[model samples]
Target: MISTVLQAVGLFVATNIDDIIVISLFFARGAGQRHLTAKITAGQYFGFAGILAVAVLIALGAGAFLPVEAIPYFGLVPLVLGLRAAWSSWREYRDNDGDDDSDGDSATGKGSGNAVGVLGVAGVTFANGGDNIGVYVPVFVNISHTAIAAYCVVFLILVGALVYIARFVATRRSIAEILEQWESVLFPLVLITLGVVILVSGGAFGL
Candidate 1:
């Protein structure tokens, strides 16, 4: 039981380290907009739950019909997403001529008075979590359903805690400033690195 609990903690942290940055940005958006914090939190959890559901399904499938080794190929989803993010950032920078306001506008979706919609945030979370499926499938396949259930419980609890942490960091002026400044560049890089890590760890590269 203790081991399963520890495993759950480790998996959550490993899969979600980048989420800290994403969550912080959402909370920062909330700070700028009116009463968006709760929405962002709900969206984030909704998105995370989606990722978990997909991973669990894939894991279950892997036990029967799917080949375990093929799991690493899923990393390509995040790799492409990361590359697209980078390309978009480059295009935005070039188009805006490096204007800070433009960056703010893009990050915060300025046209909208309210925070991002629940589905919008969920989409971001799901895209960002593409690599998570690769990591989670094996972990889930190796364990019993009972352990998986425990992990789910722990993950659901931690998702809320993570939002609180992100909100706390977002409320801080300096940290929020830094996130806004670098998130466009940093987010893609994190996704790219995660994809590479998944591929390498899973031996998908045949290395």
Candidate 2:
């Protein structure tokens, strides 16, 4: 049981890779206030929990209604999403702002906004969680429904905690800048890797 739980947790963490990246962008943009970070984090946690629970329950309770074969189709969703991100990243690199500071400065010269509204936060959380759901559905298809919910809850809490920590670091503007400078190369590399992972998981190589 313990090992199963650990495996579930690990998968949850892996599934949330895209969420972490999107939230990092929000932080870099300075979108949320100190308190707002907590709020948004909470929203993401609960939102993810809610979504996961629903998926599990629906799979269990409505198993007869769903096309079991559709389970693998979930993989296609993330593949498309990953391909989209890859395209976006390539475009961003091509349009690389010539005057944009490569040294952690905001390329658009825009201040991170303080008033990230509730709906906006929810929207961001949902958008960021999209890939997670895609990864999860396929994994949960054959698992016990309750186990799926448990994994979802645990995964969400971990993601929420990580987001909170990242936002806290975002408050320390100097730290954010310094880390970004040193890790700048890593950022694009991560984006590229995420794209590849999404495609691979979706069976794009076989397709």
Candidate 3:
């Protein structure tokens, strides 16, 4: 039991450590908006729940549900999201030229950009997690249902912890300033790059 618990912790952290930067970037754009923070958190949970569901299904003999090679197609989710974000950023600049009170959709002139709200966050989270699906399927194999439940519980708890830690980093004054300044550029670029990498690295490109 202890071993299972430890393994769950180790596996989850190892697989999900990279999410810190993404989650932090999301929080950085919150700009003290508590509602936005709640949205981000809920979106994250929603996205991860989808991932877990897929993994569990595939592990439980639902192989036909999604062929292994098709996982790369998930990259499309983030790729499109990135493109959408980029478009919003560009439009914001073109229309308002960074004016804070120009009556743009975001009065702040520095909101996280359009299309990057709850569903957008959730979509990208699900998209960027292609690898987690690959790792989780095999890990769930042959394990007792009890251990699986333990793993899931531990994983969800740690996900909340991950969000809190990233939020702390994002809320730091210095980091927040930089993120706010470049969020328009950085967020889309990061998302696009992540998508391309996932597609290419999966060893089978295209739908």
Q: Using TM-score as the measure, which candidate wins?
A: 3
Task: Rank all candidate structures by their lDDT, best first, as comma-separated numbers.
Answer: 3, 1, 2
When sorted by TM-score, best at the front, the candidate numbers are 3, 1, 2
Candidate 2 local lDDT, 87-139, one digit each (tens): 54445455555546543323432223223334444544543444555556667
Please list the C-alpha lDDT of all candidates, in the order they appear.
0.71, 0.53, 0.79
> Which stretches of candidate 3 lie above 4 Å from their native place?
32-34, 98-107, 111-115, 204-207
Specify the highest-lDDT model's number. Answer: 3
Off by over 4 Å in 1: 62-110, 179-207
Clash count in backbone of candidate 1: 0
User: Stretches of candidate 2 above 4 Å error?
Assistant: 28-34, 61-114, 168-175, 178-207
Worst 10 residues of 1 by lDDT: 107-116
TM-score (C-alpha, index-matched) for candidate 1: 0.65
- The C-alpha TM-scores of every prediction are 0.65, 0.54, 0.89
Number of residue pairs clashing in candidate 3, backbone atoms closer than 3 angstroms, sequence gap of 3 or more or interchain: 0
Q: Write one digit per residue (lDDT tens) for candidate 1, span 110-182.
A: 3343234576566667655657776787899899999999999999899888888878887788887876666
Which is better, 1 or 2, measured by lDDT?
1
